[model samples]
Each structure stands twice: as structure tokens, then as C-alpha cells.
Target: MSTEAVTVPPVRTPTSRGSDFAELSRRIKAAGLLERQPRYYLLRATALGGVTAATVAAFVMLGNSWWQLVVAVVLAALSGQLALIAHDLAHRQIFRTRRPSQACGLVVGNLLLGMSYGWWMDKHTRHHANPNHEELDPDVAPDIIVWSQRQARSSRGIARRLAPLQGYLFLPLLTFEGLNLHASAVRAVARPGLKQRRIEAVLLVGHAAVYISALLLVLSPAKALAFAVVHKALWGGYLGAIFAPNHKGMPTLTGNDRPDFLRRQVLTSRNVTGGRVVDVALGGLNHQIEHHLFPSMATPALRQARPIVKDYCREVGVDYAEASLVSSYAQALRHLHHVGAPLRDAA
Candidate 1:
């Protein structure tokens, strides 16, 4: 799933930074990069809906055949795309107001994808506020896998045993991410304090009921189970790969290490270098530096904002990190392996 929100702090920068971000912001505003692209989102959503319908038709047509596995892969890709749309919705990139954004997000995330918009919004807000901060960013929090040497040292039980091999196992571990996201949504809705808990709960339950029922009705029990596993696994892997390059190997922040707005985002975020195909696959997340700097900017506009941000960063002497898709993954894996080095030494 995509990580995004518009809850970043106000434009506070250090004096040495010299209103650098303000200048960049002015250029972006003059360029009209912040405006919403209603037509783009409309056509995109329409195309996604049509593809989903066709996939469902194919599922019925194929009917209990082992070839349904192919259909399962298509559904996984579609789910990833739907999640990306929901990500834009959460950021108000499609709709400016909270009501419209939340309405669309719930329909796409909870109803269609069986993921929780409310839960994801909360987690993503903190992440945008602090992209790679060890303590603040939930995306980097130490859990099943650790992101830092300190975390690797503190890891216990399964996490400890897994830490040393985590770099090698990262992709394999991501196969379960789809299940983790669904389970997290369920737990979030079940607990107290989440906004619109009842509505989210109802939508989530409805999605699960319809999804499971459709699978069972269309195929045999064995085939249904296999289809579900493949769909979830591939969906998780696809989404995880999309997000991995954004900040995994980038420098992380910690206690009291606050940089200016531009430096904070530009320093910690890495941009993936690719053409239109990569942009489509990653949902414009390849330009993560731009996305983090302007959380509410529409996905399509990120490409336009990139050069402006990059040039301003150079003038201000902030490092702008960019890498090819393969190189980015390699850098992230290397960082993971390096972090686990202490654990290996201790062993």
C-alpha cells in the first residue's frame, strides 16, 4: 500500500536555510503544480473499475481451471493500483476537502480493497511528518524486522533470530504484508478511538464477506484457498517493492535531529529514476522526494515538481538522492545487511 498524508508541519526552516523552501514553494505555485487533476483521476478510476470488472468476468469464465492463478495475479496488480488511488485520496490530491477525500478513501480502501483508510491515515500522517525518523515513523519502526543497529540489538525472540537474515529475507517477508495490512485494519476498526469506527467496521466486514463468498461460489474450496493465497502474496510483494525505494537506504533522523522542511524531506527520501512505466507502476512514488516535500500535490504533477525541487536543493547544498530501480533496491538491502552486522558479530 502507498504511504501518504497532508498532515506535515507548517513551513518552519532554519535561518541558515534562508527561506530556501519558501522560494521553491513559490516556484511550484507559479508552475501550478499544486492544482488537482480531476480529469486524470477520473479517467484513471474509470479505467481501474473497467479492468476490475473484466477480471471478475474472466474469473467466472475460467471457472475452476488452474489458469485461475493467472487471474489471481491480475487481481493482485489491480488491488495494488486501487490502493494507490486510495493513497491519493487520503492525501486530498483528488479532492480538496476532508469530507470528499474521506468518502472516496473509505469506498476505495475499506470497501473495495478491504484496508482501513482511517488506520492508514493516522499511520501515514506521522510518516510524512517524519519520513525516516527512527522513533517517529511507523513505517520504520522495529517489529518483525529492524531498520537500525540499535533496533537489531534490542530485538527479542523471533525478531532477534530473524534480524541477521532479514536483509536476505526482506522480499520473502513481504509476501505476508497483504495479510498484515488486512489484519491491522480489522484490529484498528475493532479497537476504540478510531474515527468512524463503526462505518469502517461495517465496510471491512462487508468486503470480507463478499470477497470470500465470491471466491467460494466461483471455484472449488481448494482452488479458492490457493487463489486467495497467491493474490494476497503478490499484492503485498508488489506494494512493498513500490515503497521500498522511497527511504529504506536513506539516512534516518532521530531525537532532536530536526532539519529544515526541505532538508528533512529531501535528505531522507530517495527518488527512483525511471520513465513513464516506472511512474505508472509506482504510482508516481518514484519521485518520492517531491511527494514528501509537497504531500498534497497530485501524483501526475510530481514529475513536474521534481526538477524545481532538485535544483533548489542543489542551490541550498542539500543532497538529492536518486537511483535506478535495481540500484535503489540494492542500496536498501545493503543497509539492511549492515544494520544486522552487529547482531551477527554478537552471535
Candidate 2:
């Protein structure tokens, strides 16, 4: 954990940003934490896959009983776990080569989680390249909800009415996020433009066919529908809850604001403080600042790199935001509520 003293960069000034990036990168690289451990990755993938399979089996065993609700909860939890694995595979975090990673992503994402790997990679890459950017970051793009004053002001009709209450609605809306992701992926793969669209579309179809068939085989149609809704909604909300705190409350870059790479990432990403269970559940996204700094870094390594990165930023007078999970969500909600005030004014 020893390192040379690094020079501090001035806040909001980009002149010395290159030095900051170089210094931080140097420290992180020096630790040799960047090296991939195949065993770790394989172990995680195997365990999560087992959980997914076991949960699916349990659901089938439950049949049309009142106890299927318990199986649905377990399935939802496993779905979230698989989604995290899919995200890691998407980032090429586990496998050194692209092919294996892509294969794994297809198995976990498209087949198990019912998400399109190609579609997610496209959107996720843009998000990583320009996180929290008002225009470029797909994560923050104006839609049914608004995250900033400009977006709130431009709202119309139903969106306009909902804009003011968006903070309150955020968690509730996440219940539909799983369905939205499925629909969006379907549309993206249907379009002629994406790479390997046909393959991804087939995988998605396979997911739907297998999933629906399994549920309907044992349960009545109405019960199956209920189980599906619960599983998907809970999965979506779990994903959203983990990801939202990473950047929702952070300073967002607009067209005019162009900070250098290190500064922009550090300023925009927030970390959460917790132990291994939280790390596993969040897919090591609890170390979001470190992950954003080094997108390809393995999740296990992110925790080791955290103190080094945090110390460097502290020495350089850069802000490194980290809070408890509860605190971080509250901050995000507060930011959303504050941003929505403009919508109220517009009304």
C-alpha cells in the first residue's frame, strides 16, 4: 500500500487532469491487482449458475401450490445474480478473450435473464464512455422520467404531471423496468442495424419460450402470470435499486461541461460501503468509482484498489463520494426531488 506522494489537481480545472489520470493509473497498475484470476471468475459463474438452475427446479416442483410464491422470490433473486454476471461478462471482466465472454454473456443475459447482450453492450459502452452526460449517456437520456431541470421543463402531457412526483415514483416505476428492458431489447434486435441481431433475437425467443412453457406446465395461466410478474418486477427493481445510487445524485455533465477523464469519472460516480454480501449482491458495483475508473478490472480486485484510488483522489483534492447504502439512496431521491421542482414551477 506504499506509494509516492502525488500532486493535487485544482478543482474544475482541466489543465493538470492528465497528471491525475496518469498518477492514479500508475498506482493501480503498480498494485498488480489488474491481473485476472481465472479460478475466481469460474467459481462465481458456476455458483450463480447453480443457484439459477436450482431455483428454476424448485419452482417446477412447487407446481400450483400456495408455496410457489417462495420459489418465485428465490427465482427473482437468482435472476438478479445472473444479471450481474451478465454485466461482468459484457465488460469482459472475467475472460481475457472476447469470445468466451460473449458466450457467457449470451448464456446468462439473453438465455437466463431475457436481456440482449448486444443491445446491453451498445448502451452500456456509451454509458461508461460518458457517464451522467445529459445527452450522450443513454442512462440519463430524457424519457418518461426527468433527471434534470431542462428535462423536467420540457415535459409534456402525462410526463409533465408525473415529472413533479418522479422522485416518489422512481422505485414504483422500477417494477416495470424488467418488462421495459425486454421490450426494448426486442425492438432493438428487430431493427436491422445491430450486430448479430438474429442470434440475439433467437436467444431472446428461446428465453421467452422456455420460461413461459415451464411456468404454464405446472401452474394455471393466471397463477403463472402472477408468478411471472412478481419474478420480473422484483428482478427489475433489484437491478435498478443497486445501479441508481451509483450516479443518480452525482453532478451530471451537460453539453458545455467537459472535464477530463479521471476528474469526470471520480466526480460522477459514488461508492457504497458494505461487506462481502453486499459486494456479491451488487456485483462489486459497491466499488463503483473504482469500476468506472477501470472498466475492465475484475470485481474482486475493485475492493483492493478502492483505498488506493480513494487516497489518491483525496491527496489530489478531488471529491470521492462514498456513503452507506441507505444514505446513498436518500441522496439520489433528494436529488430527484430537487430536480423535479422545476417541473412544478413549469406547471
Candidate 3:
């Protein structure tokens, strides 16, 4: 296989970061190892099955006043994970068959994120292709991308620091100042595509109607609100950590700084969760190194790639960061602190 040299930016370290990233990308592409459709489908079925059962369980267990909050949190987490499953399925990164994945994505990912499969597929494909590029990537919303170039004309330092942390756990801050929400909005507005925009609009309206009707007409407002808030909080927290770890703390792009696209994903990502919890909790996404090596590869294979990728990272002198769940969460926070340091710009 011919190896491509990746050009690094000024802010980047003069190391093998880009090369390692490139190597993984090349391996994945050459191997033709994409997602394991059957395994992915099975995982989805199990997670969704659990979620559906849990929802019924939540209703049945709602009888426990003391455990209501606990049950709610669990239920919400299940749904969020289910949504992510749908996301994987939709991308058919899990299942190459578009029709099956699309059907599930339309149902689960949309319902879970309060979004639509049609709209998400379009923008998300663009994001994976060009992450953190101010021009091409509309994913800059949320707390990650603050201050337009207008806001950062001079003091890039203060501008970055001044960005909002939004919220920590057990707080509703994330729900109100949603990064994904802002991302989809800005992206929809900027892109001049009416069809995708309309799809997004329908999703939002459809979700809102469901939320309202469920909360008002079915469950007590207290119950509905409780469910919604807890569920969103769970999903939001996961998204926050994943996004921050992905590229926010690594590098920003001018959209033309790099030619090795797949390599950048490798350098910018880390794999965590080396245990069964990796499977039960993160769906093996913690094996980001493996995923980078094979974008289309299923999550189960991520564990298999962990050792190979780690050794490769070490051989090349690039950091192969892997931590337990506890450490990864802390590292994620530290990452936010590092990247979130204020940048002062008078724009």
C-alpha cells in the first residue's frame, strides 16, 4: 500500500501524529473492513429491546417514589444509547445495507436525539469528512465554537477562554444551551439546501409535538418533564465527552491545512474503555483507535484493533492515549479546561 504524507499545521507538534493517523486510515481502507452488519444489528436489537423493556419497566416501577429518579435516569441512558445505536445503524457504518439502517435510524436516532435521519445523514457525513473546519464543518456550534472570526480577530486567546462550559452533571445547563441543536441550526441555515432544512424542521416539530402530547396528555407534566430532562441530560453528557475528546482539544482547521483526511481523525482521537464495560456502556466506541483504523468496522472489532493500534502509536512516538472509564472522564474534563482556556479577541 502507498502511504500518504499528511501535512501538519503550526499549532501541531512536530511528531508522527499525522503519520500514525494516516497509517490507520490506510489499513482500514485497504482491509475493506467496515462495520459488521450482523453484529451491529444484533447489538441494536439487544439495546433497543432493553430500552423498550425498560420503558415498560419504568412504568411498572414508577410505583416506587424513592426510586423514581433512579429509574428515570436509567431509562434515559438506555434511550440515549439506543439513539446512538440508531446513529451507527443509519450511517450503515454498522450495516452497509442502507435500507435497513435508514429505517432504524429514522425511528431510533431521530426519536432519541429529537432529530431526523434524512437531515442528520447529510450533515453528519460532511462532519466526518471535514471535522472542525470552520468553512465546511457546521458542527462548530454548541460551546466548542464560539466567537466568529469576527469575535477572534485579535485576541484569539481570550476568545477561546470566554466560551461557555454550559453545564456539568445533574444540571439542566446542557439542555438549554445545546451544542448539537445549535450545530444543526447553523448548518441548516448556512447550507442553502431547502430539502434538508425542511426535513430538520419536520423533525423538530414532530419531536416537540410528541414531547408535549406525551407530557401533557399522557403522563403528568411532572413525570413527562422528569423523563425528558433526565433522558436529554444523559445523552447530552455522552455527546459532550465524545465531541470534546474527538477533536476540540486537538486542533482547529482552516479547511485547507491538511490533505490526509483519515489520518487527522486518528491523530485527533483516543481509545478508552478496555473492559467489558466498554461493550455494555460505550458500545465499544471507546476503541476510537480501532474505529479510526477502520471507519466502517463494527464496534466489536474495535477491541481487536486496540492492541495493534496501541503498538503502532507507540512505535511512531505518537500518544496512544487509553484510560479506564474513570480516567477518561477526568481526561475529558482536563481536555475541556485546556482547550477552553479563554482567547481574548476584540472582534
Candidate with the greatest TM-score versus the true structure: 1
Candidate 1 ranges beyond 4 A from true positions: 1-18
lDDT of 2 by residue, 17-60 (tens): 45678878988988997888788887987887687678767877
lDDT assessment of candidate 1: 0.89
By the TM-score metric, which is better: model 1 or model 3?
1
Candidates 1 and 3 compared by lDDT, better number? 1
Query: What lDDT score is found at residue 267 in candidate 2?
Result: 83
* Cα lDDT of model 1 by residue, 1-347, tens digit: 11211123344444652587788888999999999899999999999989999999999999988899999999999999999998998899999899999998999999998999999999999999988888999998989988888788888988899889889999999999999999999899889999999999999999999999999998899999999999999999999999998999788777776777787888789999999999999999999999998989999999999998888877767778899999999989888888788899988
Q: Score every model by TM-score.
A: 0.95, 0.94, 0.72
Instruction: Estimate candidate 3's alpha-carbon lDDT, on a 0 to 1 scale.
Output: 0.55
- Global fold similarity of model 1 (TM-score): 0.95
Please state the error at residue 3 of candidate 3 in Å: 26
- lDDT of all predictions: 0.89, 0.84, 0.55
Over the stretch 1-347, how does candidate 3's per-residue lDDT look in tens digits?
Answer: 10111245323243553554556556655555553658656766876787678776665656524355576667656655765576577556766677777766756644545655566667677777765555566565433334233223333353344443421321333444334553564455446664445555566567667756745554666776776666666667655544444443344456465645444556555666657765656666777656655656776666766766677656655555566666666654454333333332221
